[model samples]
Target chain A: AQTVTQSQPEMSVQEAETVTLSCTYDTSESNYYLFWYKQPPSRQMILVIRQEAYKQQNATENRFSVNFQKAAKSFSLKISDSQLGDTAMYFCAFMTHVGGSARQLTFGSGTQLTVLP
Target chain B: GAGVSQSPSNKVTEKGKDVELRCDPISGHTALYWYRQRLGQGLEFLIYFQGNSAPDKSGLPSDRFSAERTGESVSTLTIQRTQQEDSAVYLCASSLNRGSLNTGELFFGEGSRLTVL
Candidate 1:
């Protein structure tokens, strides 16, 4: 099986600043996927970004970017120019194909980020 | 709605009782997943459904938890003899395809909060 770990249980960042949340995982599979999800107070889980194992380049989406160190098995999320809307519970997830088109995700404990004003 | 839909945004049930949570995936989505989020914890994969293949039940914590998806649309997660440990938010997600495929993006619902007391 696979396991994802988020050492930070909580984090706070001032608005317009930058913040990085740490994540690590244990997996033996060579090909897989990584994802970051955000759950706001409304309880909706939203996909923030994704990274593919085969790619050496980290994934980025606007202010959301990832520093993926394959050798260290580390995938951290960097949020730049943070906004109050970024305050949420962030999760790091791992996935690998199970069958033809089936896959399962293993997720970390999560980091509650509060973007302070 | 254009997004995945989950019912009973909030459900409070007594211990040992049975509770069912519903999810309606976005139209045309071929894959669906269920995850559990306990208080102050990361998401735990419960089950996954893709196309007409057998659903993956490996992630289920126990036999007390079972889920069924009708075709490619609606899914229901049933917890029998619920325990206090079952008190958590149940999240549902749907994807165009599994990870490593098309988008590999899972669109999530707001989630159903279950409180077993």
Candidate 2:
């Protein structure tokens, strides 16, 4: 069994500023994956970034990056140069790599992020 | 569509009524997933289908919730005698056959929002 937790319920960042959303997960499996997804008001879930347990290097995509601490079971998402479009509900998810493929994702409670001008 | 598709973007039904939500996964995708998100909450995984394997229903909250996928394409999640607690967004996602190969990218649909009054 796996569980993800996001302590912050809401966060705000000024346009062109930076913000970091925190996440923590509990898992017994040694091999797994982590992901961050953004859901805007449009109701679409978009992939933000991903991290692999086997890789020590955090994953980054464009202005979105992650700080993955495997020992602490923490994975946080950092948004640099935030824009209005960055406002959304951010979700942290975990997936165990069982027998080579992906399994169901365990998601956190979510953090609502608002980017203001 | 180039991405996953879900139908009945918004469904409002009275408590005790039955509701069905549909999902169309990306073509050629071998994996499909169903998840639930309550208001101000993160995703709650419901079920998963991979290739021709037996679907995993471990995450379903109760017997009132059931889902089916036909030949790795369309999936339908049905709630029998829904309760007020069933009000939430139902999300669907699909991933390439690479799921077993460790590529965990899940293309998601816009989701079907259900309101039980």
Candidate 3:
């Protein structure tokens, strides 16, 4: 079984500043995928960024990027120049590269991020 | 619609009552997924369906929770005798193909919020 852990329950960042949310996972499988999802007040789950375990380079999407350390089993999300719209609950999820024939995801508890003006 | 659609955006039912949630995946998507998000918490995988194959119901919390997908399109999640603990947002997602290595992005719906009193 794979388990994702987000040690921080709550985080706050000043507007226009940068913030990093930490995530760690336990998985015996060598091939896998790591994802960060955001849930806003509208209750919609949106994909933030994703990293492939085999990729040595981190994944970056505009202001959102991931620091993926496969050896350490760590995948952290970084949000640059945070805006008020970035305030949301962030979750880290793990999936098997083999596909959902296994049909499941292991998610962390979540970290509530508040972007203060 | 361009994105996945979930019906009955909000549902409130008394304990022990049965509730049914519906999901309509993207037109050409062949894989659908169901997940639960408790308030102030992360997502919990529930079930998954790919094309016309038997669904992977491994993530369902209990036997009381069951889901079905028909014609590789619409899906419904049914909870029998719901408990107060069932209160949460139910999310649905879909992807083009599950077997492909490029299946990284998942389109999500606004989610159906279930309130069990």
Tens-digit lDDT track of model 3 for B22-49: 9999998887899998877788888878
User: lDDT by residue for model 2 over B1-117, one digit each (tens)?
Assistant: 698999999999999999999999989888889999898778888999996454578989999998888877888899999999999999999987574454887899999999999
Flag clash pairs in model 2: A101-B100
Prediction RMSDs, each to the true structure? 1.7, 1.5, 1.7
Error of 3 at B110 (Å): 1.1
DockQ-derived CAPRI band for the predicted complex in model 2: medium
Mind giving the per-residue lDDT tens digits that candidate 2 earns over A3-101? 999999999999999999999999899998899988999888898888889999989899999999999999999999999999999999998887777
Q: Report the Cα lDDT for residue B75, model 2.
A: 86
Across residues B18-76, which tens digit of lDDT does each residue of candidate 1 receive? 99999999999898999998877888888888864536878889899988888778999
Q: Could you tell me which 10 consecutive residues in candidate 3 chain A have the lowest summed lDDT? A: A97-106
Write down the worst ten-residue block by lDDT for model 1 chain A. A96-105
- For model 1, state the Cα shift of residue A67 in Å: 1.0
Question: Which portions of model 2 miss their true places by more than 4 Å?
Answer: B52-54, B99-101
Error of 1 at B40 (Å): 1.4
